[model samples]
Target: VFVCKKFLKKDGRKVRKAAKNEIMILKLVSHPNILQLIDTFETRKEYFIVQELATGGDVFDWILDQGNYTERDASNVIRQVLEAVAYLHSLNIVHRNLKLENLMYYTENNHNKVVLRDFYLSRFENGPITEPCGTPEYLAPEVVARHRYGRPVDCWAVGVIMYILLSGNPPFYDETEEENTDLHNRIIFCRIVAGDFEFDSPYWDDISPAAKELVCRLMEVDQMLRITAQDALYHEWIAGNGASEKNLKDGVCAQFEKNFAKAKWRVCIHSCSVNVRLNEVGNNSSRGILEEKPDEDQGLNVLLARNTTQQRYGPLKLFPSSVPAHCHSACPRRDPSTLPHFLSLDYTQMFKVACSTPFLLLICTSL
Candidate 1:
C-alpha cells in the first residue's frame, strides 16, 4: 500500500505503533474476503506494507466502471462484507473504518470476491471502543457523537456501503451543496442521529424490498437494535434473493449514474490513495497519472472501452480518474512530493479536526 514517508517524518513512535496494530490485527484474521497481509518492511525513512492485490478496483470506482450493477451484484458484495465482519466480531476485533474504499475485488476476473483491507483503525474489543474516528459520511451516529461503541459501528458502515452499492449514492448525505460544509455536516449528522433517510425513486424503484429492509435494519439508529453482521448474513435478501441476476431498468440506471456523477467529487476526496496496487498484478512498466480532465465527463465504461489497459483489469490499469493531480505514480515511486503528508494527530483529536474542517484537511491527517 502507499504509506506516506511523512509518517516516519512526523513521529517514529506513533508510526511504529500504527504499523504494529495493523500487522497484529491482520495476522489474527485469515479469510478469503479479508485482505491478507503477506509481509511488511520498513526502511530508515518509510514503511511498506505488502498485501493482496485487489485488481478490480474499489467498489465506488467499480460501480462507475461497470455503469450500473444489479441487486445480485450488490448482494454478493454485501454477503462477503458481512461474512468478513462477522468473522472479525467472532474474534473480538472491530474494524472501525469500513467503507467502499476499503473494500475491493481480487481481480477483474474475480468480481464476486470482495476483499476488505485497511486495518489502521481496527482493534481488538472487549467492550466499548471510545475512539472517535472513521470517514465522515460513513461514521455511525454513535461515533460522531463521540460515544462508546464497538462492532456495531462496522455494521453501520456496511449498511451505508450496501445502500451505495445498490443505488450509487449514500442514504444519508447532504441535501444540497448550497450550504457551507459545516452546515451540510450538521444536517447529515442530524439525519443519521434520527435515522432519517429514504430509498427514493427511481434508484430504489428497481431495488427489491427485501434489500431495502436489510438496509433499514442495519442502519438502525439504536445500536442495541441494529442487526449484527452474523445475523445480517442470514437475511433473506442476502441468502436467497441474491441467487440470480436481474437487470436494472434503464431509467434507474440513468438516475444512479446521474447521482453518482454529482457525488464523484466527494468520492475522490475520500479516496486517500489512488496509485496503490499489488506489484503482483498488472505490468509495472508504464506509469501515468489518472487526473480528472475537463471535457472528459463520458460514461466510465465508455472511457474504459476507449482506453482499455487490458482485458483483465479493464480501463483503470494505472489508477482511477478520481485520483487527484498529486498522488502516487503510475508505478510505485518513493518521491516525497507525490506522497500525502502524515500528521501525527491522536485518534480522538483527528476526528474532531475532521468534522469541523474541510475534507481535504482530513486526508492530510490520514493515519
Candidate 2:
C-alpha cells in the first residue's frame, strides 16, 4: 500500500533502521505462517509496500463468528504461530509484537490456516532490545521494565495468545482506566515480573492440564527459565499426544461472544489514540489512511493497515502508525494514558472502529 514519509523524515535514523531491519528480515524468511512481502515502490511523496492479502478476517473475529473451537483447533493455530516464532528465533530475529490482530487467514475460504503479519517492531537479537515496543497486554515483564530483552519476549506473547485461545479471556485485565492503569504498572513491577497468574475455575476447569502447563512454562517471569518456541513445539499439548480433554467448544464459544462484546470496548488506549485520526486523515487526502476509491479486489473494502503500539509514548512515538518508515505521515503524538481506559462499545460507538478503517494505521493525529 502507499505510505506517507512525513513521520519517518522526522525520526530519520532509528525509524529507518527499524524499517530496513523489518524489510531485510521479512525478505529472508519464507514460511506458510509468516507474511510475504511481495514488492515495494518509492515515489517523491509515498512509498508502497506490497504484501500478500489476508481475505478472511482476523482470528478473533473469525473465532467469534465460528461461535467456538476445540483444543485441537487451538493447538493447530498455536502450533503454526510457534513454528513461525521458532524459525525467527533460530535466526536471532525477534518479533516483539505477536497479538491476535497480527495473525490473519490467507484467504476467505481458508479459516483454518493463519499467517503472522506486520513486522514493523521486529528486530534482530544481536543485542537486547530496550525500546519498550509492542502492545501492553502481550508485553514480556522485562520489556515492560525497560530491561534488555531478546527472543523470549516473543515466546511470552505466544503464551498470552495461547491463554486467550484456550479460555477466551486475558490472563491480566481491569475494567476501568484507573484499574487498568494501576494494573498495567503492577504488571511491570509485581505480577509479570513475578510470573504470577492463575487458571481460575469454570473458564479453565475443562481445559487440559497439559495446555495450562505449557502456558505456565512459556510465560515464565525469568527469561532464562521461559520455554523457547522450539521447545514448546515438543510439548504434549502442541505435539498432539496429550490425553483427550472434555469438549470446550461450547464453553469457549460462549466466552468469545461475551469477550467480543467487551473486546472492542477494551482496545488499548494507545492504539485508539494512534488510530482515531485515520478518518480525518483519510478525508484530508485523496489516498490517505483509508482509500476511498475502490480497489481491484471487491472482497476487501479497505486496505489492511497493521500496527501494534505501546500503551504509553516517549521516544517510541517517532514511529507512529507503525507503517513502514517510508510511509510515515504527520500526526499529533500524545500520551493517551490520561484518558479513560475503557470505552463501552455500542451502536453509536460503531463509528469509532469503522472510522479507523486502515486497521493498521497506527497514527493518532490531533485532528
Candidate 3:
C-alpha cells in the first residue's frame, strides 16, 4: 500500500483526484506483466492505493543486490517489460514514468514474473498532459523540451531501461552534477544524439546485435520513426526461435481469427434447390409467389461468411452461365414474384466500401 501526500503535497483534494484516476486506469487494464491494483481509499490527510506486494522488490534494488545482471537475465526482464508496454498501448495508455525503480518481481509457486508498478505519470493517448515528469535519466528529448507527446515517450524510457539493464549504467552520464545538467540540456536540444553514443564495455561484447538494434530503434529521437509496441513484438530478439515454432504459428493464427471476427458486412446472398412454395395473390388470381428453403450443406460457408461479413446471404450464387444470357439480363428487371425463386440477393452494389463503413471488403482486408 502506498499513500500519497505524506511528504510531497499538503492538499488532500488533489491527491484524491490523482488517486481516483490511477484506480480507474488500473481497473481497466489487466496484463500478466503489470502490477495488479487491489483497492484504493482516502483519508482526511492522504489517499492510498493498495497494490500487490512485490516480494522481489524494485528492479533497482534487485540489480544492486546482484552487483549486475547477466545479459540473459536482463533480456528476460526487458521482454516482460515490453509485453507490459504492449498491453498498455493496446488500451491507448502510456506508462510515462517507467524506470528500474518502478519494476517489481514476484514469486508464485517458485516461478518468477516481473510486474510493472506505479502509474502516477501514466496518461491516455493524446490526453491533456502537462507538467514534465519522470526521472531525468530516462526522459526523452521531446519530454525534456516540454513538448506534448504520446505513447512513444514510453518507448524512450524503455530504451533507457534497456541500457541500464545491459550495461549497469545509463547511456549518458557525467562526472559532476554541473556537467550532468549540461549533458541533460544537450540531450533535450537533440545535440547529444543517441547514434553517437557507443557501447564499449566488455558486457556489450557478448550481447546480440538484434538486442542492440532494438534498443537503438526504441531510442530514436523522432517519435514517428520509433518502433511501435506491436512492431517491437515482432523484433528479432523478442520473437527469437527459442519458443516452439508451432506455438508461434498457432498464436499468429489466433490473432488473425480474433481480428477477422470483429469485421462488419454490407451484403449476404443465399440460394436453395428446394421445391418452391407459392402463396395465392387474390380470390380470382392463380399466380403464386415463390420461396425456397435454406440448404444445410452451406452451413460452414454461411458461418464463414457471417464471420467474414456482418451481412449474410444464404443458399444463393450469382446466375450461372447455364442460364440464358437474355434471362440473366432480364432477371434484374423482373418483379420479385416472377424472378427465379432459387436466387436470393443480398450484396452491396459497390465492390468495395470505405474503411469506415460496416462492409465485407474491410473485413477481408483485415484477415
Every model's TM-score: 0.67, 0.69, 0.57
By lDDT, the better pick of 1 and 3 is 1
Q: Estimate candidate 3's alpha-carbon lDDT, on a 0 to 1 scale.
A: 0.50
Tell me model 1's lDDT, rounded to 2 decimals.
0.60
Model 3 CA lDDT for position 154 = 86
- All models: lDDT? 0.60, 0.61, 0.50
Where model 2 places Cα greater than 4 Å from the true spot, the runs are 1-12, 175-190, 243-245, 260-367
Residue 11, model 3: Cα distance from true site in angstroms: 2.2
lDDT string, candidate 3, 1-367, tens digits? 2211111124333334545667679889888898776555444543444455444555544544443345566667878888999899989998777876567777423224888876755767867443344544566655544456788888888887887666555565533434333333334223223333566555366566777888889889887799987787787777774321111222222322332222212123222222211111111122221123243321111111233333221211111222111110000112235523213322221111211222111111110
Q: Best by lDDT, which number? A: 2
Task: Tell me how candidate 2 scores on lDDT.
Answer: 0.61
Look at candidate 2 and tell me the lDDT of residue 137.
65
Candidate 1 collision pairs = none
Question: Model 3: residues >4 Å from true position, as ranges?
Answer: 1-14, 60-69, 108-111, 127-130, 177-196, 241-367
Tens-digit per-residue lDDT, 1-367, candidate 1 = 2222112323335445655677788778899998786555455654445455555666655665565457887788899999999999999999887877677777877777888876766788987875455555687877655457888998999999888877766787776853443354555655676677898877677677788889989998888999999999989988886333666635434544554442222222122222322211112212221222333211111011111111111111121234222221112212334534435555455444434432122223333
The residue-level lDDT of candidate 1 at 22 comes to 71
Per-residue lDDT of candidate 2, residues 1-367 (tens digit): 1111222334346555665666678788888898787654343422334456565657766666664467877888899999999998988899887887678777778887898987767878888675566655677877655467899999999999999888887776543434343333333334455456789788898888898899999899889999999999999998866634456766666666664342322232222113211112222333322223332211111112222422322112224334332322212222345423212434233224323333222222222
Model 1: lDDT of residue 219: 96
